[model samples]
Target chain A: MTGGLVYLLYVLFAVGGIALYLAMPRTQGAHAKAGLVIGGGAVAGLLALCAQVYMAPHGSNIFYYIFAGVALLAAGRVVTHPNPTYSAVYFALVVLSVAVLLVMQRAEFLAVALVIIYAGAILVTYAFVIMLAQQSGGGSSADQRAREPMLAIIASFVVMGTIAGRVSDLRELPNSPVEVQATADVMDVPLADTPVKDAGNTLSVGRTMFNQYVVVVQLAGLLLLVAMVGAIAVSRKRIPADEHGPPPPPPGEIGRTVPPF
Target chain B: MLLAFTQLGFSSILALVILGIILGMVAYSIYFERKIAGWVQDRYGPNRVGLPTLVGDLLPEKYGKFHFWGLGQPIADGLKFFLKEDIIPSHVDKPLFLIAPCVSLIVALIGFVVIPWGGQVAIFGQVFNVQVANPDIGLLYILGVGSMGVYGVVLGGWASNNKYSVYGAVRATAQMLSYEIPMGVAIMCVVLTCGQVRLEEIMASQVAGWNVWNLFYHPVAFIILWITMFAETNRTPFDLAECEQELVGGFHTEYSAMKFAMFFLAEYAHMITGCAFLAVLFCGGWDPIPFVRIPLFRPEDTGIIAMLAKMAVLFGKVAFFMFMYMWVRWTVPRFRFDQLMRVAWKGLIPASLGVLAVAIAGLYLGLHRTLWFTLPGNVAVVLVSLWVMSRAKDPVSGREANLPPLTRSPELGVQA
Candidate 1:
């Protein structure tokens, strides 16, 4: 990547940061309209820059463009939306479009699993919490205003810039035809034309997971189990008297049952 | 007997045809729900709404007056819905409110595409499948789409800006999340037993050479799936979200006109899709008999007549399942909210997990398809679950362990 292109990328991120800071919901001074327009422009500029740099190496499909655009747009809405419920809903849209993008890359099982877990389960829980919270206390000042917007935006943009720099560096790797074809096979080919290719994809994923990554999978499951146990322990109710260290039950009364209501 | 259309064209045409059939079925299912309610309560339903006046005039008076068992009532009901005033309440979130019903209807409609209505049809010497699309992850696709149904109800409830509506949405979210676990586990049982994730392959496994339907081998899983299906569709026994006595029409309380009708249509559409999916999974889809595969209706039989016969058989199974839905709705009373949660978390989830375990064991034993291994395994799981439930120590109605200890009220002379 050229020094000029890197500078241009930084400029775009700076513009996006400004737009996002301006767009963050507030109780007064509605600059949302201006912020949204500026943010959209910044995003489009970023996309164009990326397309110019990478479209030659990665032969573009129209669906790749459409779904990726929608994912980015919805992700922006997820952050900028005033209402928490709407934010969660926009997040679901992001999940869906990203899932479609995954499917285009022939990760059908992973794509559907993403929809089921993230869009279906996690986002619904988020929406539920937002709805319950809003009912209890309708739109607090905390929800209405962004906290330390400039610092947060700068921090995130710095991380994104670093990743972008690294990605650009990847383009200079030994561009062997075999590696190029492998990359194209893994990333560029849409599975819709030959769905038969997908039949083996799931099987291969399962085989690889259980064969090579079996320990990793089991450890992940164990981590989840530990988290669940911790959650249950934290959420369990304790009587006020118990905080003062109540005496143990008498020997004869040990394991005594509580009467049903 | 076919045209000059390409295979893709024919599939597209079949997709349209299936859509039309499903819409028609949805319209009539509502009528049948009412008719079944009437029958259960010992009264006639929609008998007054015969053919339209224009159509009646073209027929003889006696025949027109016969009412044709209220066959035209759905059409009349549909027309009324169209003519009615569409109301958007002032307090609601307009965008989400508008999108909710559409989401509901689209999610409901899209689930049927993977359901192989008939095995295959030979058209103009070309073999075309009688399905919209048969993705490799067909069953999971259906599950994913079914999970998406939560969005419509949640959005509708939230956007209604009513307390009852919010309550309904919260309940729906919890119920769907809870039931989906057992539902997925039950499906996993089927996938394990058949060693196939594709709906057509699953069906083909059942249809191959005197093989029995999955219902016989995994009866416990079938029962679990049946119960979870009701919860997933928000039908009675599990319709806590919109139970009229408590939530006052629940999520659709604020909906009216075409929007309300869309929600109504989506419910019936969900029923049809769920039933079709259940048939494809547990019953030998498009195979007329379980143990005995008739030569004419075997899945391999790809003639036009065979395809039509297979389609009729599949539709018949779907209709039977739909009827069971209505019958159960009328027969069983709705569970209390806490009881509903208890049933899912304590009862169905464990049972489904056990069923999945049995399926895994059956697979390992190389008797997944055999009646002896699976049937007895199902029976043992059911018996064990029942025994465990009987030995349970907690209160039956609610989560008492989490509640604070009751205090005595001196004035009321009771624990509060």
Candidate 2:
């Protein structure tokens, strides 16, 4: 009976948060809009807290809870923020929070890699794109109004609900753990020979990748090369003179384009 | 909770002390730079600005008149920055503009965490490593944190709402991204030779004999890394981001007062960190000169005095490199944008790659960590790569074919 009550409360917060997000006023004052988003974010955060409490009673580290809460809030801001640049910046916060979680899990190499690749490279590129595209301030109508917000929220929430239910169900299975452990062992056979002890964290990861998963690593490199070539081909611009003979300029225009210092 | 409090308190105190030292170093670095520039240009720099009247009055009359060769200039400059009004331009993005300098300062300051300053010291009754944190992935941490420093420049430029600032930001991002590849490759060579990623271990590995420094074996990699350091720090000859004549103040065009001061401080902080990294990787770090063999200053020595001596050795190397940075800044002309990109993509990248291949082959043939084997191999790689590069047609020149050729005569052209 108590489990049913908690489940109902979880659904209530999730649905209410999504409803508030979808109902944000497009034409309202900026302050009012910001207040609405903040209220909605609080509701979503509460929902995450409930899920965390339900999922792992043993995992009660305060730092973990704080990081998880911040990650969820930043992810929420990434999607719902009106300004595109702010959204990209918020996405960086999400990346940082995820990195902290990775650090908590003792995956130091993966955490640093996440920061370097995603926060360092990808997000910088995203900021550049945002700056290049948005010359004016972010007061565009597209930014102001969310297209099909209700549909997006409902569909995403439904998927989240399904995942949450499946996770809870898996926690109740007794024999499922043994079966999962067996599968994990089978998967670990290739990496079993790699020496991890006495090696630094990064060295171990490098050995595992090179020794056990060399083929997959090579494939990933090949995929990156192909993508780079494709990008160059698609973006290359040809000179107009190559297609058509150079047109003669007017008689007096020979030095018109040159600027005088 | 008590355990957490104790850990946090200790770390926080250590962090604050380090921060104070770095800030002081940055302040004096600006003074040193100016003095060096003045010496180069045949003029006195900041000789007039010493302590104020109040402080001078407390000193002896003779000392008061001396002015200490302008030692008080940084303090005065700091005061000026604080007293001036911070103007957030009406047209700029307020939040991003405010956050940019903080990001720059934070990222630059944090890159020093993995740098083994004094190795280990005996304090009170216990021994402790001098570094703030010695993570297993120390090298990668430095690279990762250093890379994030570009975001501060980019955000500052974009938020300024100016054409020149945006252009500067774009150039900075491109230059940083391009140079990082060669830098990473050069660092990989160091890592492979040392068989370790920890900075202190790398330092220890190089202390075997005189001329055993990584510099002796990997001269080409050292040269590449040195050039990339100048570029990464945005020093003169590579400071496209803040090219005064072209981009006005560059990314900090609209920044003023203390906010602008943060960016300036961050630049010097980055130079210090970069030089420290070079010292650790190439020079023997805190190890005494190999041939000199001063017993008190040896790498194996421990205790307070030895730690201080080692730190002094490292600092002297860093200061020498810093002077070299200033010397090059005054000597070399800035590279054009196309020339800068070509140097990285066409020149350094291929050279570093060749060095890597040679290093790998040396390791494979059971000559691992032998300077004698790798030194000649690296020299050969450098020469061969340069020869190959010379044979290739210049891409920049090839692009000029699309433009119309210049002509001086019409009807009576000499060539026609």
Candidate 3:
């Protein structure tokens, strides 16, 4: 019943989830059903986000909640799902939606940068893992790194859960952020129409963040530069087990094992 | 939650309404892109679609050449995407793939929040502001959201479980990221020079004057930003993702029907935002010219003509950039993968830092305030940038294919 488009998004996906659930075969297929569960759960999660977003007033930071929440769900799927490829992709999406959330919060510049960096470079690194890092044994159709991701998800959930109470608690949209943040909850009393006294100080602090705090920004830049270079350097060509299929031909034993036309 | 409608006064509500109107305008933007593209490619475009001929009426003439081609096309296209089946590949990491496009489109929509679209306006009785959010961190918002196109492509590609799609996603993500550094630096120069981050304030600060058209101020930075824009938008030459000759369908290959359309729609939406931001930063943003200095036509007045005029000029500038995108796409060829990286990291990064260094040096030396031989020192910085570009090595080259297959990209047989 809200204006944030909750019903349109919720109802649309609710129908899709139900349809997908019903479409599942009676035979309990691990991968397929795992897929349906992960997918249906995500749709449900998205619906929740849409509902929240729809219910939100303009300028509300509820969009951040929606973004971070859905991102958690996305990252969750990559861990729970059976396929490594799907996991990689879903994991990438988790970072991307943050960019979206940032943009919606009027951080388009950072949003774009996040997209290029996390979604672009980081995802490529993941892609390389899938391509080059096959195990000694022939990896199955299902992702063999299932345990690693499962542990990661659990570890991540624990980390997030500790912060969840405060994080999920809606961050307020303060008009004058600097002064407002300092006074917002310290006294447990809201300021109604009382304009903060030191507007100039807030501007000065903000300017300092860009200028005097330039070193941290420079460090951030360096870290990203390192990431770019590191990704490229690490992704060098190595002898792939998949390229030369299974049975151990001795190193000197070449001819028959090679791709013979 | 619907408190926005109930609790908030008219201005915020008016902002919401304007947001909706702009979105609707963006929906019709497809018609704009296609119409422009058609013109650029020497075609008639959607002229056959009649001008709303009683508001989106078609289906009476399916096969006819002018079956409401001009007016009804965007409508028809909009309907087609909505009505089409939403396909979800079984192999995809189902949840993320489903969410990526929406996330992308939403982020794309969000950038307009900080943009002072119609400058400002007044409603029935009380004054209503046009922009949705005028945060202290307004310009940063552009950098934040404008870059989220990577997610849409990456997720779509990664989730699809197709090799080509994944490859495309990776390439797109990498290209976007690589270009963003210089792009960020270039815009920083613009914002830093202006001395305000808030959109409204930035526009107001330019009352004295705009910053050198910026393209002229830092030519190398300007050129780098332009190239980054092209790469950022996944336009041709930088359109390595969807390169049919290489990676088929790029990130959206596995997506079909409405889901596929979401990716398609998101790309264009993001493209428009790219153009909008470009216009906002360099081409005087909402300031048509610095010294309009009219007393009656004040900064945030509600005169219909002035608002319309400002909107028209801003809209015109964005459209010109869009046209340039199409023109460049048609004129240029795609860059090779290494070539693309070489340009962004090797060329743009060093050059951008050089520009930033000059700016910082100028500030410390107090050269910025000083006008040399009647020209501002910043103007001199701009001229020097042009000279450096003239001397810089041109990216693509003179001769071809003399190298042995052992050298660069042994996969493609180039000199390593």
Candidate 4:
């Protein structure tokens, strides 16, 4: 009964947040928009609190709450921010917050990898593109305006509900023999023999990736190669004239009467 | 609550000390850079500024004339920056413009946290390691934070609402993206050989042993790393981002006063961090010298005096690298934008990749235990790659045909 009440409250808060987002004015008064965003954030935070209270008996520690809050806040800002450049910057913050969470989970390799790959390379490139292509007058008209806001809000809420339902359903299922055996196999690996003392986690991760999922790794590498080639081909500029076109007259002769020769 | 207070107090004290030392080093590094530049140009650098007026008045006339070889220049410069007018252009993105320099300086400062400076020292019956944080992924943390430095440059350029600044930011983004690949690969060679990502462990592995320093075994990787460091730090010949001839002041064009000073400080701080990283990775952090076994200078030598000496050694190496940076800045001509990209993508990337391949092959052939096989293998890889590179068509040269010829010849002055 408590879980049902919590779920109902979560739905109500989510809907109210979406309504506030949609009701925000398009122009002239940024304060109203900011107020709406704050309202949405408060509702989202309450929903998260409700979900956490309902799902976990132990309740997450302070660090988990802090990182999760930062991640969610930044992620929200990334989508709602009007300026594309600020959006990209907020995306980096999201990546950083997520990296902190991953570190908390003892997945240091993944955390560092996310920072290096997403925040470092990918988001930097995104910022470059946004800055380079930014239109005059702060931004393009489309940037200041949201399209089909009502539809977008509803669709996003539906997706969120579906994911929440799926997660709750998975939580109720009993552990099967195959799942237990798979976990046991993972636990059986001897991580102590790695050369580096403090790098056993990374070593074990690498071992599992290469030994148990070698084929998947190879496929990923192959996919990256294909993507690289495709990107080059797609972006390569075509020469204005045919390669075998008639040779132009000599430079000095081009503008002179002797060009006929 | 008491326990938390103690932990927090200890950390806060340590952080304050480290911050103070780093700031002092950064200030002196600017002075050091100017001195090197002056020597390179055959001129006497700032040698006039000294004590404040009050202190000068208190001293005897002769003593006041000393000036201590202009040691007070950086302090004076800092004061000047503070006294200057802080300008915020009306057209600028106000918030981002204000935050950019702070971001740059903060990111630069954070990269030093994982650097094990003095190794270990005994004090009052307790052993203490002189590092802010000794995470297992120390090297990765440095790389991660180091990469974020580009963001500050990009944002500063974008927020300035100037074309030149945007161009500068674009060039920085491109340069960083290109150089990072080879840099990562070079670091991989070190990590593969040491089998450790921890900076302290890497340092420990190199002390008083055959293949003592990573520089000997990974000579090619070291060269690649050195070149990438120049690119990474935006030093010549790769400082296309802020090239005075093209981009004016680059990303910080519109910045003034303390904000501009922050960008300047950030650059020096980054150089210090990069030099320290190189010292730690290849030169053996806190090790007196490669393959030289001083009686009291082993990794296990945890005496306070020994730790001090180790710190001095690391500092000396970092200073040498910093000096090398300034020397190269005045020595090498800046690369053209296209040429810079070619050097990174065509030259350094393939060279580093070849070295990585050779290292992996050596490891596979059971050469991981010693530098005996790996050193030769690396040398062979470098030579082979160089030969292959020379045989390939020069991409930069071929592209020059598309450029317009000079309209007015120097001898002719101007066409009639």
* Winner by DockQ: 2
> How well does each candidate superpose onto the true structure, as a TM-score?
0.89, 0.86, 0.66, 0.88
Worst 10 residues of 3 chain B by lDDT: B397-406
TM-score of chain B of each: 0.93, 0.90, 0.79, 0.91
Report lDDT (CA) for all predictions: 0.84, 0.78, 0.62, 0.78
Instruction: Single out the weakest 10-residue window by summed lDDT for candidate 2 chain A.
Output: A252-261
* Candidate 4, CAPRI quality class derived from DockQ: acceptable
Tell me the spans in candidate 1 whose CA falls farther than 4 Å from its real position: A1-6, A56-60, A136-139, A169-199, A238-261, B1-7, B53-64, B398-416
Instruction: Please provide, for model 3 over B1-416, each residue's C-alpha lDDT reduced to its tens digit, 9 standing for 90 to 100.
Output: 53433213644664676566556656677777677778778997877656555443544566444444576777778778888887776777677688777866776666666776656665445454456666666776676666655667766676676779878877876787778789888776666556666776666554444233444444555666788888887888899999988777787777777777767666676777777677766666655654355532356567657666766777777778877887777667888888888878766887677777666665666654222321343455456657876797653421121111222334444443
Give the per-residue lDDT digits (tens) of candidate 1, residues B1-416. Answer: 75568767877888899999999999889899999999999999777676766564567766544666787889989999999999899999999999999999999999999999998888668888888887768999999999999899999999999999999999999999999999999999999978889888888888886768898889889989999999999999999999898889999999999999999889899999999999989988888777875789776688989988989999999999999999999999999989999999999999999989999998898988889889888999999999999899875533444334444545555433
Find the candidate with the highest TM-score and give its number.
1
Q: How well does candidate 4 score on lDDT at residue B354? A: 86
The 10-residue segment with the lowest total lDDT in model 2 chain B: B1-10
What DockQ does model 3 achieve?
0.09
lDDT, candidate 4, at B31: 87
Winner on lDDT (1 vs 2): 1
**Residue A234 lDDT in candidate 3:** 93
